[model samples]
Target: MQKKSALGIMVLAILFVSVNLRPAISSIGPLLDTIRADLSLSSSEVSLLTSVPVFCMGLFAPLAVVFNKKLGLKNSIAILVAAIGLFTLLRGILPTYPVLLISAFFIGLSIAIISPLLSAMIKRNFPTRTASLIGVYSFGMGLGATLAAGLTGVFYSVAGWPIALASWGLLAIAAILLWLRVKEPVAEVSELPLEGAASVSPWKNRRAWYMLLFFGFQSALFFSVITWLAPIAIEKGMSILVAGAVLTVMSTVQIACNLSIPLLLERWPSRHLWIMVSLGFGAAGVLLLMFADMIFIWPAAICIGITLGGLFPLALLMPLDENKTADDVNSWSSMIQSGGYIISALTPFTIGLFYDRFQNHMISLSLFLGFIAILTVFAFLLNKKPESAGE
Candidate 1:
């Protein structure tokens, strides 16, 4: 009973930390115009508020393993979470472009370092329940994005942009307090091979490379839709209000899927089937958006949202499922994420290039379809053998 209670507390703490991951970045979107007007910033300059952090997520993800090796799991998480909270609070307190830029870098650094380590922590503590716990983790992140995007504008009306951005820090403070109540994870040495898991380099692992490529394309698909779905709707002749509704549908379904997919994996555990289904939804949605009339928009949104929600928790589960020890999961996840996010961050820019040359939303959507097809091939290769499949 005591163990159960401790697990409950730990899960809540994980949820809190998962939520803090996004508000420092997502909050900027809702108030972008207001922020730009106040600061008199150009579009390219203002765009860095988001892109800089994404680049940092890719560039700094490997630091997660470094922190784990040097500071140990609990210390690393605590320090990183503190960095997230402190930099976020500084954004509100300082409230200038240069300070905001500086704060964004630190906030991004904190998130990058903590993400993979947290995955290993979940695997270590809830070895049996890793799937459901991951569901909770991704659910918390999706909830964070929703809350930040939905409420930040309202908060700005009540306070100024500074206070609005800073209000998110209160959530971080609550996260820190709750996180203190949970105990750190212990390494499971007996389960690992004779060779220490820590010494294994993911750079040489073919499976880890597969995981990296899979993660990159899936993230690219999700972010491309997030960045382009509404614009696509508008380009296809929907009014601005109607276009926003399509994006809302996608987001709503995504959050629901993020909460549910890992739980489904807990019961079904057929990774290949879920992976194919999720990718199929993504491909179908893109096709519908590209070729079908606006009447098909609702179905496309629902399908894409389902794909967004399902793929992430599954991608997260892959490393945990493959590795025996927390250290191995950390190495594998960090390696996967490090290269994965760089692939993801470049996607929007590449798509913009396609748009520049072709000048049609259809051209971009067609490119999305081609990527999805390639992703499907990788999916089959990754899960073709029964051994590789999380059966």
Candidate 2:
């Protein structure tokens, strides 16, 4: 009974932390207009605000190992979560645009550290139940994004952008407090050597390279949509509130898909097939947005949301499938996520650049479609067989 209770607490802590991960980024889309108007920022500048944090996530991913070495994974994650809360709050309250940009960087860095640590923790503590736990937290992430995208406009309408943005920090604070009470499991300690470990560098492996590309392009699709979907909807003749609601519906469908995909994989375990299917849906959705009328926008959103919901967890799980030990998982995940996020971070900014130049969604949607094509190719190339150290 005591063990079960502890497990329950740990699960709750993980879910809460996951829930706090995406809102800082996702909430911006719905409020981008308000923020731009209030600050007198240009399209590229606004894109920078959205893309910089994502770039930082890649920049700071490897630092998770350093933090773990010094503070241990448990303490490092606690500190990171607390830092996320602090920076998120500051992001909204800062008096200057420059300070807000700095806050976004810190917030991204904090999330970067927490992201890999949570994956390694799940591997260490619930080795047999990785897929299920991943699904749970992925669901939390989707739910967090859904709420932020769906309701931030409403919140903005009520209390203004600052409070609407700052409010998400409270969720991070709650995660920190919940995490404080849960004891760190003994399994989290690294059994492998600390220095000069015999792990293969992921960069040298062709299969790893494919996985990295797969991860990167999928993230490119997800973040691009999260960053621009609301604006695109507004451009398509929807009101800001309705646009936000469309993003909300996408996220809501993502929550359902996030929960279902892992379980479906358990029965089928067809990684390539599932990934290709997701890409197909994403491509269809993008094409629909490009050519279809406003009446079809909700269906397009649903299709894209399902793509995000399934692809993210599957992409994450791929590292675990490839690596045997927790340390290897951490190393490979850091490499994959670092490179992938850095690549993915370019989507919004590049899309923004195209939009700024053309003053239309045509170039941006074309770029998105190009990414989907690249993602489909890489997903097909990713190895399905399990990999081990020194492979």
- What is the per-residue lDDT of model 1 for residues 86-178, given as tens digits with 9 covering 90 to 100? 887887889999988888788888888777677767767888998678777887878776676557766787788899888887788888888
lDDT of 2: 0.82
Per-model CA lDDT versus the true structure: 0.76, 0.82
RMSD of 2: 2.8
Which numbered prediction scores highest in TM-score against the true structure?
2
Residue 151 lDDT in candidate 1: 71
Q: What is candidate 2's lDDT per residue for 1-391, written digit by digit as tens?
A: 8888888999999999898888988988987766877898877778777798899988886676688888988898889888877877886678357866887888888888788778778867787998678777777778888989998888888888888888888898789889988884734434422212327877777777788888898898888888889888988998878999999999998888778887898799988878878878888899999999998999999999889888887888887887777666666776787899999988898888788789999777888889888887777566445374444
Off by over 4 Å in 1: 1-4, 29-47, 65-75, 90-97, 153-165, 183-202, 205-207, 228-248, 263-270, 291-298, 319-331, 349-367, 386-391
Q: Estimate each model's TM-score.
A: 0.77, 0.91
Candidate 2 residues lying further than 4 Å off, grouped into runs, are: 184-200, 322-329, 383-391
Residue pairs in collision within model 1: none
